[model samples]
Target: MSTLGGAGTPNPNKSFEVVQPPTDSISSLCFSPKGNYLVASSWDNQVRCWEVQKNGQNVGSVPKAVMSHDKPVLCSAWKDDGATVFSGGCDNIVKMWPLASGGQLVNVGAHDAPVKEVAWIPEINLLVSGSWDKTLRYWDLRQQTPVHTQQLPDRCYTLTVKHPLMVVGTADRNLIVFNLQNPQTEFKRISSPLKYQTRCVAAFPDQQGFLVGSIEGRVGVHHLDEAQSSKNFTFKCHREGNDIYSVNSLNFHPVHHTFVTAGSDGAFNFWDKDSKQRLKAMARCNQPIPCSAFNSDGSIYAYAACYDWHKGAENHNPQTAKNFIFLHLPQEAEVKGKPRLNTGRK
Candidate 1:
């Protein structure tokens, strides 16, 4: 298959275009709801907000504000109402920040282990989080304590919540979908062909189906309703290699049927869900990708942070640890006119 952008087209290899953050190893990246800013979490225990300008321009100036954390920041999410930003970290804490006032962060720690993932449901004013503590908790911004908690058999790596429904992927290669409306309800778990852990999960824009990427470099697409049945449809994505490290990150284009994934091998791939074809593969970073996020309009611009695996290496080394902002353009086709043939040849 041709590369993501087009066939025979030269790839636009852009540099990181770095914006100074407190740390180099960014654990997560999130585009704010308004698309005016980006929130990044670093292993250095800080969350920095960068202002994004219009016209696909480079980020303006340095980060506007830095939110301090007691431990390494793991993941972050922006509220739908655009009022607050939520962050999770290794200290087992989840924080909420007011975006209007220069990004002031308020600690809302309630988990027992490192919080791995968080999502906000603005319609209900609820924040849901998944943690390495083997549990999922629901928090209401207005309250100090968790409204409810669901214990899982394994550590949760990533989670996405859509109002009353929540989907969580675990380190044990299990995908659990829960009905948040009933806090006491048992989670519906779906098993995958690959026993490796799930690194990321993303739901379809229309909530029709969802995709899950595993550490084994394989992706499975499951129909929402069929996921609970004994028989389900699961497709393996990348087969180039299967080291089972981590899928790292996954994001769907807001307006397109395509989605992109990055992983341990630094392989960035785009897939067509309808055909399940590997659309494109780009240059590998030779490092582990920690996180990736797409811009608001679902344009080509996406950013990913790589972690330094070398021992005793500087965490912020520009060469070793770098954040990539890749620009993926839409595919184009050439029109060829049919040649005319002589009707009467003597």
Candidate 2:
């Protein structure tokens, strides 16, 4: 395939621009709901927002702002409207930044330990955060007190939310699913199908179930209805020479139900959830990808290639640790294929 930006054949060699912020490794990257901006948070204790060219102009590194946190900001999320942002970090604090009111963080809530993830649900006007403290806390932007809190069996590792359904994956290999209508109650609980630590979870676009990734390069496709879950299966990726990489991140395409995955092996891949077939895999990257996301409109896909401290010391280099954000204009074929045949699902 030609490497230039054309149709579904995007030129991989030419990036919109390269970013080298965050003296330490980048932890996450998320595009604004507007699709014209992206924000990244890092271990360096700063969150940088970059301007993205939606019109396909010759782009360069255009950073809009730098916000500070006391410790590594593990996650950054944009609200449904795209003007406000939420961040949580190792300092156990969750903050809200209003772009229109002058980019100042309002201390919203805190966890007992490092905050691992933050997810915003516009439907309920609610924000949910998970932590190593082994609990999930719900917050209302209009109030300082948490709306509700639910304790988990172990440290909360990953959270996946799709409208009325929310799923939490924790350190105890517990998979907890909840109905968002009643935030504090648990809907179902099951042991993780994977043998290793939970690395990531992404809800299916239709909310049928979710995809789970682990440190052992394994991914499990699950369905809420066990009858439909007969097709629930596990696959492996991120395996390089003599090493198995953690499946670091997963995002489902909005228009197409297919999903994209990134891993510690410094790789990104596209897959069809129904047919259980991989559509494409990018060239191996120079650093592990910690997180990835797609804009609400699905025109752009973004990912952060940075060092992961949790990987221990085997394959990381402090000298080479970077804050590399990648942008790709995914063609229809690369992200989606023809409608997968049902082959007669009962």
Candidate 3:
């Protein structure tokens, strides 16, 4: 097996728990808003929640609970109340889970194609989903139909919410911003900071801008405010030797303006935006790090270490690839960047 610190060998210097789950590959992972639980979606068509409350917990050790979809699960999010979970998959449907009621799967929404991203807008208690169908649908849990649907220029792949505004990245390198409070005006479309297709997007803690990742191993710091947008910039990440790897996920620390990124390079790195410096770089897996999430309290970070094998079926290696979830208690020495006011969520 690959052993990086290059192969990611188990060592004492390490500060994280490595978990092996009996699954294929992980597509997405998110932390519970209320507790130490983590919800993950996998290419195995399953969604599982693992508790990371420092009780010797790891991936396969009884995930608190597991749920399945008809096709590979792609994206997931938790409501602000932390009682309900939202999940979307290749089946083109988004399902709502009532965690307080024994994990009942309730079909809440659907799309014309595979749903690429979903997020909870707390101000309105709305669930918004974007699909390859080139549309964004807004849904209210009390109703079965969407409250409104907006068309996009191309397939929507990445999405982020920031209360007053939201951003959606679509095919053709398009980044569209919608004013949450003033929907009557035309949506604002901006040139994507990256040239490749968007892989992930996260709203900045300050709401002055956001982070956007691409399949081309690059990330762009974008500012929504006119004067600040000109100051935006991009950087490269997830490259090993000469291979270009996809940046699968990006998340900003709840309190720290700094952020973390996971990539197909089989690693994740922490960064400080203001200083433009890397806080930490971890080479801890043999497969891609598809997703990573921070807990509500920001005391812990959970990540999925697995082979997305997203290149194609021909590139998959079942014997060599193992599925896992890792939880790390980041020390101040490892990730404490300059602290800033914590924004609620995206």
Candidate 4:
């Protein structure tokens, strides 16, 4: 419900608001690569797109489009060039949309089971989708059929493409990095050190490495170019009692070398990728945050689908705290030659 700037502080001077869809959990949210608009999907089986105005205003107009699905829409991603968008839902299908217009959904069948993740790779005009059917399918927008499909050992929850490579995370806590440059070869699967389910995965913008989040409140950072013997940097995130019911969403900053994560405990934390340190912990929510994304300028924004009753829920009421975007600004540094007060008595 907010956007934070590079410094990880909430920007009070600027903000934007989107009309909240019907009461349902937000399954996914995405910012267009151009940063002029945003799309949010919910368990209510709706996808709503909004136009972002200057100074953080949502324009108060109706959504560009409100697409419907048979089941909850789970995830969404925009093409690198912002020409198209891809979305998946519980209906077990991946759909493509034209961004120039108000996103008209196009059916692209890939799995017999519910599709869990959908990612658009603008570099090659390809779309990668994962599903509960235990498979990853690659689609060429120019063709009506999937170009290739890889059967996985377990249900794949998340997927991302880094040019000639694609990364897939499974429910079994395994991470597989595939070299698409040689599509004829098998994928290089790497078993992560995570003990529980791998809930989410995000590749660095530069594609040097990727991070994986688990149900046990842990985040593991893996390097792609390093030797297999190299150790992954792991960090415990939430409280002991607040074990991650779901590490559902993750996003990298557009400018800063940091990333953000949200979990079922309703907590969102920003971490420095190079240092592997937690930079800031935003306000915890009453319900789990299903999805989040950053703007083109590195502003952080997130949406939560409240499912539980707690203190965080009280503060997040639609009537009182209904802003859909949080703006975080860098705190100004104090001048070095500033005047100082003296405690000496005359």
Candidate 5:
């Protein structure tokens, strides 16, 4: 594993580029809850997995398996057992790959339009998918048809699930929340705190609330309880003077609970929502980071740097655009929350 061009000097927090990256832009990156197995879905119409091997201070990766879809894959999720991965794509279909068996993907779900996001609900053993067709479908892997469907206010752009809590960010600045205990009816529907289109949404580790990022380079923290509405707030990030960039992804540290936001500006930062402070900000890469994920223990951080097509296809340069996934060893201080200062007449 070799560190790439970014910081001019050597630093532990700096990223080491992962080998055998996707040929096209990366749409999503997910780490298995059980281990360091990373599964990535890409616009190349393929889903690939890699096993991150860490030896003392040195780190490396081994390619695991690959699966293909009829169209670009937009999102992927791992089964609770870590033996299987579910991926949805622009082909309007979702496929399940049993990695342990090295078996071919089996079509398990479908949408009227391109599926934008897919997530596995371990609590109920159901697969939920959000699509541009403006519906959320829950699938039971045994059947090809969805077991249940819920309509959305608009096209679904992003979806996240944590047991008993699910949040869907849709077009027209719509934010839909679901209490997975019911898993059918909508728990709440509200407008996005940000004025721009939602780029990503991630649940807090504790499942109390979620963080939503918008195309305008801003993130909003909203609590589920209306009594705590006063605590709901928003912050601006990934901005350089007059240039603002879309926040492409938001992932929480599994242990520390602090979250990181990757953006189109090629920068990512760790933030403590409770302390309302940024824990650390890393150096910006030369290209945008479309997606990122944190390993189960919160020791390893992975991010993909490439053109996200935010500027449209006309601006994409096949020769100049580079796609690489970087594995970073996050230091404790860089991710841990700041201690609350003691203020008293001692």
Candidate 6:
């Protein structure tokens, strides 16, 4: 257990909750690539933005913009310039909203089923969306239809993109890898290392591999290369005695490469994969942290604490559900990896 913070010990000075959070549960949170602007997609069929204003040591936010879909928005991503945001949702439509333009949301693409994830691939200059229809679609944005559609093993549960690398996790514990250079074809298809349902996946900062989180409260470190398979491993987390919770989201630090995991346990932990040690463990909140994201500079860590609907309708207490978005400035010592001790013997 890392000592920066433990369960039931939240330091008000180190973190602040964003005011005016979504009325309903939040589905996804993403920060702009070029600035402090943050966008959140929610179960209320709305997408909202906040400008995180920073002055010296204090950080705060002012609501900037809001948009809506016919149904709840599921995922969001920012364009390379950070001026535009793309969101997809239960409406089975992908909409592109250019924030700086003060323009109307445009329909860029559509899927047969609800779009579960959307991401901007700057290198290819295209927007990719994953859907429960068991397909991945690439959109050119200028055109109304997707440029191409690639089949997936099953309905996509999560998708992560990092430059030339893209990984899609789907139903039945299927994992598909794609090299964006040949964006339309599957590079490799494999089974998830974890035995349970895949909850989320995130690419390594270096794009060498990815981290997969499962419903069993475990995470798997998988490398793309077979030669590096020796380094692959799975570890348990977000568990208390006999009770376990799903690992809802995984995010990598933009600069340090260390990663953070937010879970249905209502807690988040920062871990250094290289050192195989946890850097920090955040005190658990009253609700599950359904989503999280790091800014372009990794200066701010944003997480959403709300009812994730994981345990189904019977457990959800709408009257008591808490929806909060928190911003925490992680200390270097809490996210940076420690130097490995050298033994005299080889």
Q: Pick the candidate with the highest lDDT.
A: 6
lDDT of each: 0.67, 0.81, 0.79, 0.67, 0.88, 0.90
Q: Pairing residues by index, what is the TM-score of model 3?
A: 0.89
Q: Model 1, range 1-346, lDDT digits (tens) per residue? A: 2121112322234433545644456778888777667788887788887776545433343467777888888888898866578998888889998876655577765798889999887666678888999998889887878988888879987876654666788876778887666655755777755567677888766665577878666777776675553423465543444334557677876666477777766556776666545566665654555577777766534455355332235333544344443334333211111233455855
- Segments of candidate 2 deviating more than 4 angstroms: 1-14, 57-61, 313-319, 341-346
- How close is every model to the real structure, measured as TM-score? 0.81, 0.91, 0.89, 0.79, 0.95, 0.95
Query: Candidate 6's residue-wise lDDT over 108-213, tens digit each?
Result: 9899999999999989999999999999999998898779999898999999999899999999999999999998788999999999999999999888999999
lDDT at residue 66 of model 1 (Cα atoms): 76
Report the C-alpha lDDT of model 2 over 17-66, residue by residue, as the tens digit: 44556677788888887657788888878878877766664545577787
Order of models, best lDDT first: 6, 5, 2, 3, 1, 4
- Misplaced by over 4 Å in model 6 are 1-14, 343-346
Report how far residue 290 has shifted in candidate 3, in Å. 0.9
lDDT of 4 by residue, 1-346 (tens): 3321112223223433355554565767777877667787766787777765544433342467667788888888888877677888888878887867755678876588888888876666678888889988888887768888888878987876767767889877778887767654556788876778787788877877788887778888887776842646788886536343556667776666477777766667777755545667766654455567766775435454344222344444443322243333322111012233354845
Error of 3 at 135 (Å): 0.8
Q: Model 3: per-residue lDDT, tens digit, 114-178?
A: 99888998888789999999998889998889998888899998888887778888888888888
lDDT of 5 by residue, 241-300 (tens): 998999999998889888999998788899999889999888887778889999899888
Worst 10 residues of 2 by lDDT: 1-10
RMSD to truth, every model: 7.9, 4.7, 4.7, 8.5, 3.0, 3.6
Model 2 RMSD, rounded to 1 decimal: 4.7
Q: Which stretches of candidate 5 lie over 4 Å from their true place?
A: 1-13, 342-346
Worst 10 residues of 5 by lDDT: 1-10
Worst 10 residues of 1 by lDDT: 2-11
